[model samples]
Target: MLEIENLHVTVDGKEILKGLSLKLNVGEVHAIMGPNGSGKSTLSYALAGRDGYEVTQGTMRFDGEDLRAMAPEARAAMGVFLAFQYPVEIPGVVTMNFLRTALNAQARARGEKEIDAAQFLKAARAAAKTLNISEEMLRRALNVGFSGGEKKRLEALQMAILKPRLAILDETDSGLDIDALKLVADGVNALRSPERAMLVITHYQRLLDYIVPDHVHILADGRIVKSGGAGLARELEAKGYDAVIRSAA
Candidate 1:
């Protein structure tokens, strides 16, 4: 469970999240739909404790702990995962190696026993298969020279393997065809459970068709202006962002 109150964040000295407040409870899937510059990604980064995205005001409480007090790795170990809109390419680090290291690191941070090589191999392969990631792909460099769909699937695979408590998916459906999108969405949907929560930040409603959210919120000017059930997502899809903002105004 994550609670944010009047969160104000600034990136490179320019404010992005302005008086934004959102609370994600266990077992709830919240979708944030907004046009560009509405601070959706900022909220994700602020929650992930990314460097340079400073919280100027407000408090973020994760699992009852002050989120700002913990390092980024600490947040991940606390079951927070952020799937970037544009996954960075890390050359030289094989996909399997990167995942193994990340998983082991998080486990060690949380006082859990490190997974042995055989266990990691079995788990990674299973998770990757759910995302349609082949063994060949996992042997390649991490997100290097991969297509957009490949990158997104890889992100989903990471989430599946991590089994995060709160997953923040920042435009995971971006740059994908209908088929590819379905694959990625299915991977995301598989991770949904009563003990987990997800914040799906998407610009379009098509993604919602596959990964249905329990609540949909319209974020504008760095704050959530409206909240509704699944019907709201279809309304925005039919009317567009400008219409929604005008109506909210």
Candidate 2:
């Protein structure tokens, strides 16, 4: 559902992703494991069409549509969802209202009827419950004073309600405890469908255990150095990225 070819991204005059190419097909979950400064998050931002992530070269297409030409909101409306590693706190905006507005906005953008308030509230409540989000938390300002786990769970809740075709999770496992991690992973796994694709970017292999990916890729210095089946992640866990990167080199 997503295609990126020879993508070179520059952030603040520094080239991050150099000649990176990846294609995620429908009904697949791909894990990208890389060390720090390897441009893993850069890839996610570029795909989400975030400003300042200039695509200096190559092309990014989402389901045959040019992503580079689309704005961030347009990309989100086109079924692209990004779960940030550090979710920002939007003070004064109630979480439930924000979610409902976002969902309905996407629906309207797609030329579909907006969801009724009653229907939206029911769906949102169910999703929040599945993610272990409390009613009080939903009534609070978006991500305001939330624990890291709570913020991540809210991200998953948004994903569940929106049902994006391509979900880019940028370190969704970060700052999660064992229990919180399991809850978040379960939420993600529940969204897996024949028409959905997920790109999971993480540093540790522990996250992979919960969300088993169809393929594992080793990204280093802004490009994918190796691609393999699920075993590749275990191998990286065993030998470390240094050894695997050296061997791949």
Candidate 3:
């Protein structure tokens, strides 16, 4: 569903991703493991079309759409979802209201009618319950005063409700505890479908145990140095990234 080739991204004035290429098809989940500053998050930003991460060279196609030409909102409207490592707090906007507006905007972008209040509540309730997002939590301002786990679950709730074709999770597992990590993973796994794909960027393999990626990739020095099946993650964990990088080299 997504294709990237020779993607070079520059944040500020320094290049982060150099000649990175990868493809994710529908019905697959890919895990990208790399050390800090190895361009893992940069790859996610480039995919989400975040501003200031200029794509100096490369072509990204999302189901045949020229991904680079679309704005971040357009990318989101076109079924791209990004879960940030640190979710921002919007003190003035209730979570429900924010979700409502976002879902409505996406529906309109896809040429579908806006969902009604009753239908939205029904969907949100089920999704939130599975993610352990309480109705009371929904009434609070977006991510405002939520615990780290709560914020991550909120992101999962958004993902489930929107059902994006391609979900880019940028360190969604960072601050989560064991139980919270399981909850977030369950929420993500519940939304997986034949038509949906996920790119999970993480530093630890512990997240992979819960998410169970279909493929594991070693990203070093801003590019994918090695790709393999699920066993690759376990191997990396046992040997460490330094060994893995050298092996790839």
TM-score of each: 0.98, 0.99, 0.99
Model 3: pairs clashing at backbone N, Cα or C within 3 Å = none
Order the candidates by lDDT, highest first: 2, 1, 3
Task: Estimate, for each residue in 1-249, the C-alpha lDDT of model 2 and write its tens digit.
Answer: 788999999999999999999999999999999999999999999999888999999999999999999999999999999999999999999998999899989999999999999998888888888888999999999999999999999999999999999999999999999999999999999999999999999999999999999999999999999999999999999999999999999
Residues 1-249 of candidate 3 have per-residue lDDT tens digits of 899999999999999999999999999999999999999999988888888999999889999898999999899999999999999999999999999999999999889999999999999999999888899999999999999999999999999988899999999999999999999999888888899999999999999999999999999998999999999999999999999899789
Model 3 regions more than 4 Å off: none
Instruction: Provide the overall lDDT of each model, using Cα atoms, as 2-decimal numbers.
Output: 0.94, 0.95, 0.94
Best of the candidates, TM-score: 2
- Least lDDT summed over 10 consecutive residues: which range in candidate 3? 42-51
Candidate 1 lDDT by residue in tens digits, 1-249: 799999999999999989998899999999999999999999999999999999999999998999999899999999999999999999999999999999999999999999999999999988887788999999999999999999999999999988999999999989999999999999999999999999999999999999999999999999999999999999999999999889998
Number of the predicted model whose lDDT against the real structure is largest: 2
Model 1: runs farther than 4 Å from truth? none
Residue pairs that clash (backbone atoms under 3 angstroms), model 1: none
Clashing pairs in 2: none
After the best TM-score superposition of candidate 2, give how far the Cα of residue 104 lies from its true spot, in angstroms: 1.0
- Once fitted onto the true fold, the runs of candidate 2 whose alpha carbons sit more than 4 angstroms away are none
Listed per candidate, the RMSD to the true structure in angstroms reads: 0.8, 0.6, 0.7
